[model samples]
Target: MTDAARDLISKAMVDAGDPVEFAAYAPSNIALSKYWGKRDRSRNLPLNSSLSISLAEWGSHTEVAPSESGIDQVSLNGEVLDMGTAFASKALKFADLFRAGRAQPLKITTRNTIPTAAGLASSASGFAALTRALCGSFSLSLSEAEMSLIARLGSGSATRSIWHGFVRWDKGRAEDGSDSFATPLDVTWPDFRIAIIPVDVGPKSHSSRDGMNHTVDTSPLFAAWPDQAEADCDFIEAMVREQNFTALGQRAEANALAMHATMQAARPAITYLTQDSWAILERLWAARKNGLEAYATMDAGANVKLIFEAQSQDDVTTLFPEAQVIVPFAG
Candidate 1:
């Protein structure tokens, strides 16, 4: 860990009598403005601010407790994971931030409600929940903002996953990333909906982290992205607050396309959107021309997610029968 990271962790350290079971749940989120590049990889600081809407009831549940077997253990969705597995290794490494060379053995269990590594924000939810569980297990009294700062060490998008509904992560101007954290927006639109059109539900061809680094290093077009993305984030946040669905939908779709365009400009080009993904966008565009009110965004994977109001639910479902609709603010 970097000195900045270690210092932050040290400050948040608390003493608990004994490790007891602590569990937390965090909702998966879809970025509206998109977090495409990083300013600081060690701390997972973003190059530009981004906004997202949480997926209600579709996320991860994580539990942390002292290991009964006297050794570290990890499980995902009830399946015991080998210590060398990627997820297990990453989870344990994250735990090390709190362990700080201590010999405390922890049992970390995470169960994701959404498809893992399939374009949905599973890592975001996973890390957010783990951060919460770890804090609870250690009896730490940190605020959500503090937790968000810590969770960014796990995943950049995880900073936003600390809350439900609309959230924005500010790409703070601190060298140590101490000011970088996410906060929930004060607006709530109960009719807001998101629909997932899964193109490939398996693990992505490339991780978002690797893809981001490669694009930043090789994509000449990325020079223009940071500034444009910052402007888009501000605009999208305003639209969300004003409940302007039309403006929000348009800018969100444009921003997603712009992000992908930068990736296409990379040396050797990294294309996550498959032919089928384009087909969905083509169909969506055609429907939009005929007055269907919805916009699409994609991440580092092939699946497409559409943002629309409750009024367009029937039309969206009629157009894409396979789409899985989720009401973000539903009780």
Candidate 2:
């Protein structure tokens, strides 16, 4: 087994007894410096560090227990889901971690409030919640750092969702990926809110994982993403510490665009920005020009998340009538 697997097994100290069940809730996080590529595919380690804000209103609640049968049973939002697809892959990873060296199947039931394919951070929350639930059910007393490490194995972005408010996932250098985990930053600005605009509620044409893989393997622009993202993370972290809204918003927007540009330059040209998305982005630029403090960032989906103040909610709602305002989650 790999060192990563060994470390995980070392943490699984649950005694063999009656199956234990427990539930946990974890909120999704929007990346300020987008994590778009991987350094270690097997371990799901990122090429560069990223900073994110956990959403208060968007999250997932998961319940996990040992299954009597040998097969794993997974359910999401009251619907029984197949375990082979991309969606259930996180759950599968969770079960594998929960079982460790033991041959045990898991029954996982998860419910997510985050809208599917809305460009929100549902996978982050989903995996984090599942990991938390599994840890609780198995009575594994893992530190926050260890939990973040396990969460990263499920989904790269999920590492940051393990914490509340502003969090940063360091791009560690270990081949075993013992250090590639997220740390919660101090919440310097509590009023820093985001407006989640759902341009298209339908599923994304290309998954973030698939897009990142394509870009890393084929995109010429991918070469520079790591350095740029790292610098952006450093700058953004300082901006947060100083509570500089203007600099933070600007850096967030630039970092997101840089990540998307690499994806767009991939061999197959993985493009997630729609015409409506561009219109919304332009509106944010206009709002910023007009002193509205509105700055936008996007993930692998077409939806745009705008960073603004709670006092500017009226203007934000008026500009994007369908946008939903999300406050920073306190984990």
Candidate 3:
């Protein structure tokens, strides 16, 4: 860990001994203004601010407790994971931030309600819920914002997963990332909806982290991304605040395409969208021209997610029968 990260943990941890069982749940989120690249990888600080809407009831549930076996353990979806497994190893390493060289073993169990590693922001909810559970288990007195800061150490998108509804993560100016954290946006449109059109639900061929680093290092077009993304985020936020669905959807779709354009400009070119994905977008465009009100965004995977209001639910479903519609703010 970096000195900045260690110091943050040391300052926030009120107690790190005699841990008790603690559990937490965090909602998965889809970025409206995507967080593609990181400025500080160690701290998971972003190059530009981003906005997202949480997927209600679709997330992760994590539990942390003292290991009775006197060794660290991790499980996902009730299946015990070998310590050498990627998820298990990362979880234990994150726990080490609290242990701080101490020999306190922990048992971490996480169950994700959404598809893992398929571009649905599963890591975001996983880390956010783990952060909450670890803080509770270790007896940390940090507030939600403080928790968000700590969670960023695990995943940049995790910073926004700390809350439900609309959230924005500010890419702060601090070198140590002290000011970088996410806060819930005050606006709430109950009619807002998201529909997932899954293309490949399996683990992505390339992780978003690796894809981001590669794009940043090799994509010449990335030079223009930070500024353009910041502008897009600002505009999207304004449209969101005004509840202007048309403006918000247009900018969001444009921002997503712009992000993918950068990835395509990489040295070898990383294309996450498959031919089927483009077909969906083509169909969506045709429907939009015909007066269907919805917009689409994609991440580091082939799946496409659409944003629309409740009024367009029937039309969206009829157009994309396989789409899984989710009411983001439903009770």
Candidate 4:
């Protein structure tokens, strides 16, 4: 959890006499493209646009409950959090929406499905669940776009979780980040499953947050993220219109890794690319290297998720038998 929210949740606890508990969920996903470096840092808005699909099989779930008497309480997979402070931090971001005219406090509790130190995007799922649970508990019915804005205040990548299938995160032109919300794409999910294989490399070398920060502060390629992100967005629109699996597969694989390339050129020239990460990529490349059309994409961390037709499940399973494949059930 972000420290600013953690502190606020703690303060809310002292003032509120009561708090309740409820369950929330944060689903895992692979960025077919990527969501990186924020344009508006305070709001955690992105510098470039991105597209992704929510992975139904490999994600996180959280629980948030607030009492009728006072503030709320939170727990993730059974561990209680400083609900008041957490909620207060989140609540503050949207003071206009929740408070209406004055200041108020809230409590939030959450848990993550991804490994704590690994590069998998638990924050995206975590923030997504937080937004959903908080909106429900507060009796506030925010539209998907509105919810995405709230999620952005929590984390930039989180904005994508507002939808189930194909989604886009746009980098708006406003300082307030009103334009930086997620829009759903046309890829129907549950038909496609993701294989998330984390290469064990003594844990992630650097966190996505730190990596993105490095990209923004130092990398010369950072200048290209926004323009290229918009181009990727255009490619996505075409992907949906054509539904060409081959184009979709190839475009996504290259774009995702390209988004991460900035970190490689950062100040210290550090990279999270380990042997296992490349091993998976190598296998994917080998498949494409042969004639079997398969594509893969990754997030900020070290995991490689293979994207292929459900019909090819057996073949994928056979090729990467060691990887954890999540076959989505039709929803």
Candidate 5:
């Protein structure tokens, strides 16, 4: 946490108007299928549908207690925040949105437990956790739907962190954005422990927020996104119900490719893949080509996370022996 974040959190603690302190951990999510598009920007509503798997080993921890003053602050990594950039992050945006003008400054403190930016959804978890914590501090009786809505304002995919395991963000029928909450399906934490070692956690080659925004405004392919997304969502739901790994992986691969497809169709295109990225991809392909059951998926970042049974950890590691592997476990 930075000094600014600390200051923000400190003020939140003492604020006469906002006295409650709230804390929560936001877990990292990997899209078996991704969410793209926007119904509303400030509300963080989606235009297209997407689904993801929440990882137990990675995410963020957040605490938002009462503020003493009329001020809010943020602190990260033991550094007092001198930069205002963190405020510009989606976390603050969602915090303010949920406050709904009764907003008091929260001294928000946060720490990342997962590999951020290395194709991990740490930001999604971070913002979602912040929104949940701030909302808690407000004495707000937030329903999961409302909380998901609040989290959405922080990041489109974040809505999933509110749940524990396999989550599906329903692109429901409300234009007011009330029906956008994610629904958790069956998930057993011990069954899904796949080690997700990160390759890089700095600036991603392409930002998800930016990519989704571009897909909405500039991509010709955006026309058909909603239909495809809805279908993928349904497919994933059934797969989870049946615990069908093949169906789940198939949907995941299609969803990931579709999310990437829009990036290529954007006005000025971009891809997060580096030589490191492709090398990992090629390795996964070679493994699969040789009749191995191994597979991998990516978001708008370069880290290539392998999807394998917890029991296959040793085998998966040996196959892509050089790359980091996250043994998947149920949430």
Candidate 6:
């Protein structure tokens, strides 16, 4: 363990019970202005300000407890993971954050309502719930911003998932990353709804982190992304505050396309879109051209999420009956 982990572990406290447990639930978020690159990988700090909305119906419930053995254990959806794996390492690191001593091993259990590692922000919800549970166990009285800071250490997008409604993650200037955290916009639009269309159910061929790093290192189009993202967020925040769904959807779609364009220009040319994804995009365009309001945004996976007014929801569902899942915006 690193010295930092050791310091945190040294401060852990426990009761007389043989096992002490903490559990929490956090929802996944869909980024309107995507965070495609990291300025500081060690801190999981983003290269630009990104905005997202937390999905109320999709989330993860995570629990952490003292283990009987001396080694850390992680179980996700009842499947035990090898400790030498990266996922398990991350879970163990989170468990270590709540340790009062080096000998205190932990067993972590996480259950996700949504699919994991398919570019739907599963890591975001998982890490956020894990961070919340571990902090609660330690009785740490951290604010939402402080909790976000801890969550970002595991996944950058997870910082935004810590809040409800619209969230904006600031790409802070501090080297230690104290200023880089998420803040809720404190506004909700009841008329706004999101319908998720899953085009690819399998895990992404390239991890989002690796794809982002590749784009940052090799894509020439990356130079303009941060400024574009900032402008998009400014407009998105304004439109969201005014409840202007038309303008909000338009900017969100444009931002997602621009982010993907950068990835396409990377040396390895990472493209997450499938033929079905393009077909769905064509249908979204047709819906708009036909005078029905709809806009689409895609992450690092083939799934397409459509944003439209509540009244047009049935139309969207009819347009994509093959949708793997349809969920409304819950903030």
Per-residue CA lDDT of model 6 for 1-331, tens digit only, reads: 1332223333333332334688888888999888988887777878888888888858889887777786678988889998787778887776655564547677788898885433475889888898887776556656778778778878999999887778998888776777888999978677777778877778787889999999999999999998889899889988988888889999999999999999999887999988888999998898789988989899988989888887997888888886544343443
Residue-level lDDT tens digits of model 1 in 31-95:
99999999888888889999999998999999999998999999999999999999999999999
Q: Candidate 2's error at 182, in angstroms?
A: 0.3
Cα RMSDs, all models: 1.5, 2.2, 1.6, 5.7, 5.8, 3.2
Instruction: Point out the worst 10-residue segment of candidate 2 by lDDT.
Output: 9-18
Model 5 TM-score relative to the real fold:
0.85
How many residue-pair clashes does candidate 5 contain?
Answer: 52
Candidate 4: segments with Cα more than 4 A from true spot = 1-22, 67-73, 81-119
Against the hidden reference, what TM-scores do the models get?
0.97, 0.93, 0.97, 0.81, 0.85, 0.90
State residue 196's C-alpha deviation in candidate 2, in Å.
Answer: 0.9
Q: Candidate 2 on 38-144: residue-level lDDT in tens?
A: 98887898889999988876899999877767678888899888878666776776576556657667788889988664557578999889878877887876887
Q: In candidate 3, what residue range of length 10 has the lowest lDDT sum?
A: 1-10
Best lDDT among the predictions, by candidate number: 1
Q: After superposition, how far is residue 93 of candidate 6 from its true place, in Å?
A: 2.3
Residue-wise lDDT of candidate 3 within 1-331, one digit each (tens)? 3445457678766455578999999999999999988898778888999999999899999999999999999999999999889999999999999888878899999999985424475789999999999999988878898888888999999999999999999998888888889999998899999999878776676899999999999999999999999999999999999999999999999999999999999989999999999999999999999999999999999999999999999999999998888888897
Q: Which stretches in model 3 have alpha-carbon errors above 4 Å?
A: 1-5, 115-121
Q: Select the stronger candidate by lDDT from 3 and 4.
A: 3
Pairs in steric clash, model 2: none
Q: Can you tell me which runs of candidate 1 are displaced by over 4 Å?
A: 1-5, 115-121
Model 1 alpha-carbon miss at residue 119, Å = 5.2
Q: Kindly report which residue stretches of model 5 are placed more than 4 angstroms away from their true locations once superposed.
A: 1-17, 88-92, 98-103, 116-121, 193-199, 322-331
